[model samples]
Target: MRPRKLDQPRSWPFIVGAWFLRPALVMTTKRDWIDGLNIPATGGCVLVMNHLSHVDPLTAAVFTHDHGRLPRYLAKSGLFRNRFLGIFLRAAGQIPVERASASAAGAYAAAVEAVNAGECIVIYPEGTITRDPGLWPMTGKSGAARIALETGCPVVPIGQWGAQELLAPYAKRPDLFPRKTVSIKVGDPVDLSDLADEPQDAEVLAVATGRIMDAITTIVEELRGETAPPERFDLKKARARNGRPLEDER
Candidate 1:
């Protein structure tokens, strides 16, 4: 099938961001994008993906853009602190998420509004890069499920691998030699039908969140060609085991 053209004009910030990122991606990563047509050519939807490296966003954005949609990410609020970056992010139409705060409600509202208006929003349910020792997906937050339930839009799961090699989790430097192969596979919309009618209570949200994460993990397993742990890693447990303060963690 032919890819659809972007329905809206590209913003200057998105154009500029793509300009810088495209070359770096071409230089350092060989992309293997599969089943990209699974992403709806036009509509409001949530793209749920596992967070591996800082570079994954660039790769994912390119994949979505190539498929005719501009990805709007629910990014951490800290990135907007710099005046220039703040301006660019706003201009690029990225949503800022105030992690672990009451203000996060605003982000949720904005996401719902965007979805209802037929925009694609990307969410990393794990909230941050996986703290898993083996780089597997960890326990997810409930935002993605909640948003899907609220808007009744498609939630597309994507499994991505190889970005870690380009830039390891929390590593200061990126290795640009020998060009890494970045594999990304798109999965069908998650089956949230059973819980669609349920009230958006904690129990309902938890069940929906589990389904979303399970779908994403299954796709990741396919990309990695390995089995994930029977149980996902819990960040709270990891912190307690290491006796690290919550604020000190990333």
Candidate 2:
């Protein structure tokens, strides 16, 4: 079924996003957004989704938009280096993250602030497209857990599939003829209450991150109708095995 057109909110970013994304969505993929109402109508929240393909962001943005929330992604600082793209991203209120730098702390602070101010912050815990050969979720980073712990907001986990079929990871060409089915399943807010009041330590953060990734992996497993591997794939190890450097850390 075609997605129903909801009244666009009067925000410039929302307007611009819808203007370009809506038609592209209709033309490219058949969206299956399940449990969209799981997203709160009004409140500060964090959304953690597994990264599949480069196009996943656009598909995810469309899903979030259809659910009545404008997703503010923690995009890489590189995307903002382009003159025109930088202006547009800044105007859209997206946060720029400098990986492996002292300035990354500032990005974390900004994300916490955005959540406290009642905005939806979208984060890919894996920090890039999955290195899992089968495209299952891999080991997640601690950023999402840190933000959730700091802001005390709901961390909604989303599992998605099919974007890879349209544009496989690191592929130059896209298959645009037959529209693919982008299946998105939203899981309940991960329960971080147990660790909310606990001191933020490596152990606590790892536990919280595991919970978030498990939730995402479960949903993805359901969508694919297959069990995930016993252990989550490690990108670093994969790169080491291939004797290559990590290329896409977005």
Candidate 3:
């Protein structure tokens, strides 16, 4: 669908990516995009979604692009390691995040600026693929909340599923025999007005993050038609377990 209006010039890199990726995705997968209109047609906003597979971003990009807004992601720094790919990503206006390092904070500043500049900033609050046994959204990081609270932009929660079917988390191979349905549902903007001006401390951030995760998880449940575990997965505990129990992180 063509955007009703273009708030920003479609950058060359974005155009190139769309030209190459959109058609490939169309052929390789079936799309089930719901409520994409929730994504602001032309405004600065924070778009948060669950992370399930490396392919998640690509499918999400297609979803967002078709909805009339280009997604500028908080992509991991490792994707920028390759010289050619790094140049393309930089030209595409993607932000790099050195997760778990002090430098990771830089992405927050960049994301806030992007949101303020009338661009949609897509973030996977999980920071990485979920370690949850059921592949439900796990605990979230504060980056999305920090950006939303800082800019006071609309925090849009998008629930994603089915990408992992195309390429399971951390799996080296993709299963492409039967076209997978990439289901994406956009939920209402998470309301933070009550705590908008409150002190931006750990407690406040945690609350905001919880609301964001809850919104996303609720949508994911709707998409999957399954209930998420009562307690969200704690990745820190998984790390302490030396990442054992494999897929059954329960």
Of the candidates shown, which would achieve the greatest lDDT relative to the real structure? 1
Give the TM-scores of the predictions, in the order they appear.
Answer: 0.95, 0.93, 0.93
lDDT of 3: 0.88
**lDDT (tens digit, per residue) of candidate 1 on 16-111:** 867798788888889888899899988899999999998898889888988889999999888898899999898989999887689899999999
Query: For residues 50-136, could you state the per-residue lDDT of candidate 3 as single tens digits?
Result: 999988899998788888787899988888999999998898899999865688778778888888888899999987888798999
Which residue pairs come into collision in candidate 3?
none
The candidate with the higher lDDT, 1 or 2, is 1
- Per-candidate total of colliding backbone pairs: 0, 0, 0
The per-model lDDT (C-alpha) reads 0.90, 0.89, 0.88
Q: Which ten residues in a row have the lowest lDDT in candidate 1?
A: 241-250
Error of 2 at 237 (Å): 3.4
Q: Can you give the lDDT of residue 164 in candidate 3?
A: 97
For candidate 2, the TM-score is 0.93
lDDT of 2 by residue, 42-107 (tens): 788999999988889889988887787888999999999999989888888899999888989999
